[model samples]
Target chain A: MKVTVKLFASLRKDRFAVDDFDYQEGATVGHILASLHISEEEAAIIFINGRHGGPDSPLKDGDLLAIFPPVGGG
Target chain B: MESLKEYLLARAENGLIRLSIQAWAVQNFGLTFPAAEETILGLNLLPARYQRNQRSLSCGQQLSLFRSKVAVIGCGGLGGHIVEELARLGVGNITIVDPDTFEEHNLNRQLFSKLDNLGQPKVAVAASRIKEINPAVTIVSVYDAFTSRNGSVLIEKVDVVADALDSIPRRLELAEVCEKSNIPLVHGSVGGWYGQVTTQFPGDYTLQKIYSRYIGERGIEKDLGNLSFVVAMIASIEVSEIVKILLGEGSTLKGKILSLNLLDMEFSEITF
Candidate 1:
């Protein structure tokens, strides 16, 4: 399965801004984060196809996943 | 002061009244500038001070702005800039809440912080700065934190609240207060070159959705540090949302979060 991954804010500093990867069938959102060396704590919000998704949420082929860090400063 | 109305009417030409007329009315009728201006506006006359806002905002919209009250929590980084813009936009009454005082480290991004005000209360500095920007604006500065006990009364008089707080837990606490009070919150946060903004209306779980996992944890900003540009940009966006809410113009970020990364210049909106 081919999936597009988008990392925002500080998450992009050490990671690719956007990239495509081929994952095995039934890859969970957590699996992709772990593969990218991004811990669950590092990614504050996960969006699958523009909607909120959790780590355990399963991803399918052609799904766009966006990850954001918590930019919680005044 | 019955003749005051006729005097103002005489000075008004083509439905537009000059600030000088307001000055005259203020002096003659012992009314404040805002009072005189509001009276003339109520009579269907436009004040020349707001002439620039004519087309962008109808007379009615301008009046709505003048009648709106907004509370800005946190007088640092985000709060400072938000207060400055709100005053310039002619928001009639503004309540500024913040307990911390300025330290030397805050000069980089806090708009009201200055070398001379290194130890002054943030709210006091914000109040004085706002007076300089717009004298007609009424400022109620609370030199305390917005806790559960005081949150309700502090925001009781405000029509809307701006969440410029720094902590995740405090933001959640503020959300609870806003929800209970039935007031909308325009939320903004920044860390380094990244920032996020969203509008949380009554019953909206926008904040909870974004910071639920990060409760009691300081944001990455502590390590990345906040930048001046990021704070200013996010603050401007927050103020724009407040203006939109007050005038009932444009679409707000309700149920959505607008995440921004100045480093990559990418802005993405995510809906829950």
Candidate 2:
């Protein structure tokens, strides 16, 4: 399956927003995260389909994942 | 008397029990502030006696009620922690300004540093992090360094400002702008396992005075020490001062500078 990965902050710096990526059909969040090239320790928080969800959570075929880096504000 | 103190702390909202259970207990009890005295008092503890932490931190809640605008300039080691604290504490609106791209070195403690974010712009990363923490908050990011050109505009936009900058020149510029705008500003820094913070309202204490009086004019040292924990401590202190400014109680560091050497855990405050 294919998905659109929108990255922000440091993640955005690495890749532009709305990047196209391939994911396994009904991919578990873990798999989609892997496709986005993010690691568990480095993952700040993952949002599936614009809502907060855990990593082990599953994903649909065309889910939009927004990934952000851990943040400390000024 | 306890009710008076609550009023003093600006717990003006109805029923002002907004204070954490711990702090409410201490405030209501005649026992001294933060009293070791058993709660033998408030927070739903009927006539029964109880012992627990005391003092009012409800300042954050009330401060949020006023919905002050704050600008946090930076999102790395110091900036990262500041953002997290402010979001959870519920500041009305916060604008973050940072132009640097996330780097590998930031991983040790920079809030937004992750292997996946190795090259992401800090401002956007930090902005998204704020959203995750408190979506209700308004967190805007300027993905550029705070140069003299844009610095003043940014200062003009926010009601209060916080300086978590790394360089002395940048810090000075920010401080001066805050002074000109008459905005309350909280300043913090970390180096060699040491961190210090100060709250300066307009016409109070200029950043220059604090820097030269204590830390000196040196820029970055050859090898900076652990900054994670130090930054966190300084940030919380910064947030506390912001809370004080918001709730309209407690003395701020306006005319004072607080310096800490985390190595031996020694802290001193100097008035300018």
Candidate 3:
């Protein structure tokens, strides 16, 4: 079960500058966070392909994930 | 290509917008089917119960669910306008949390700030105005200031959050809430003669990049009332971002920062 992952804001620093991630089957959102080396606190807003699913949510095949960190401006 | 407005109006109708909506379709969309028209009644019809109030919200076929709860972290210059747009659009529920109250100095750009409201709480004043404009909306007032402890109180139970704050610390704090809650945060900021808006839905560009590369650390300062012009402009864009996100209509500033400078009236987008 391959799933896509995305990283944003402060969490972006832990991985590639771009927002991209891929993980193996039966991996929890938390597992992907660990693979990307992002702490639970750092990796905020986990979207399983645009839905509001969290680390505990199971990832399906071809799932384009997104993760954004906290930001303050304006 | 359909312009942003046209795109949203496609699913809208002339009634009370319940949930899952983007943009202000009732106030904005053209009437396809005609309804009754009187002195106060517009093209749309409010539910009979609310029709008596006259300030009821317009309805639509679907309630663009993503907009169910909109928490505006501030209620100042820009936050005022953002609240107005959200409420008038029948956003279902609007929660405005602001620690400050109206002052004589806030008269210039504050939409809900009037001479009589000079000493009133911003959240209270703004919510009252929203109620009068559209009683169908549920206004949540957080008279207390936004902080790490109270972040969940305001951020939770909402589908999306908008950042129209004044300082770096507050914006960052709210951002943390949206991040942890797995909610998309549409962030905006303005300086003298300039402002910017962006959307961070957990999997997009980080706030640090936008702040460091573009905004720098310039604090909000008063400069010839540039706050109103820039705030109003940015707030409109913030509403636009909110609408698009709610309706799943089109693209968003997900990984981009939109910059607008009144000095030259130039607007552009940058990907970082």
Tell me the spans in candidate 3 whose CA falls farther than 4 Å from its real position: A1-74, B1-62, B65-67, B212-225
Could you give me the TM-score of model 3 versus the true structure? 0.61
Across residues B1-272, which tens digit of lDDT does each residue of candidate 3 receive? 66433443454455432223322333444421111111012324343333333442233312442137788988988889999988766566788999898998788788998988888899999878886776656788989888888898778878789888877656766777788788999888776666678899875635644333223223424322336777788888998898777767779998777756566565655555
The digit string of per-residue lDDT tens for model 1 on B1-272 reads 45878888888887888867777788888999779868877888888867777778787777788899999999899999999988887788999999999999999999999999999999998989887766678899999999888999999968899999998889889999999999999999999889999999998878988886665456779789999999999999999999999988899999999988888798888888
Q: Candidate 1 lDDT, tens digit per residue, A1-74?
A: 99999988888776788999999999999999999988777788999999888889999999999999887899
Better of 2 and 3 by TM-score: 3
In order, what DockQ does each candidate have?
0.78, 0.03, 0.07
Residue-level error in angstroms, candidate 1, position B125: 1.4
Q: Which digits, one per residue and each the tens of the lDDT, describe model 3 over residues A14-63?
A: 36534444567777888887777775554434566656556687776888
DockQ, candidate no. 1: 0.78
Predict model 1's lDDT versus the native. 0.89
Q: lDDT of all predictions, in order shown?
A: 0.89, 0.63, 0.65
> Lowest summed-lDDT stretch of 10 residues in model 3 chain B?
B32-41
After superposing candidate 2 on the true structure, give the runs of residues whose Cα lies further than 4 Å from its correct spot.
Answer: A1-74, B1-66, B212-220
TM-score of 2: 0.59
Best candidate, lDDT:
1
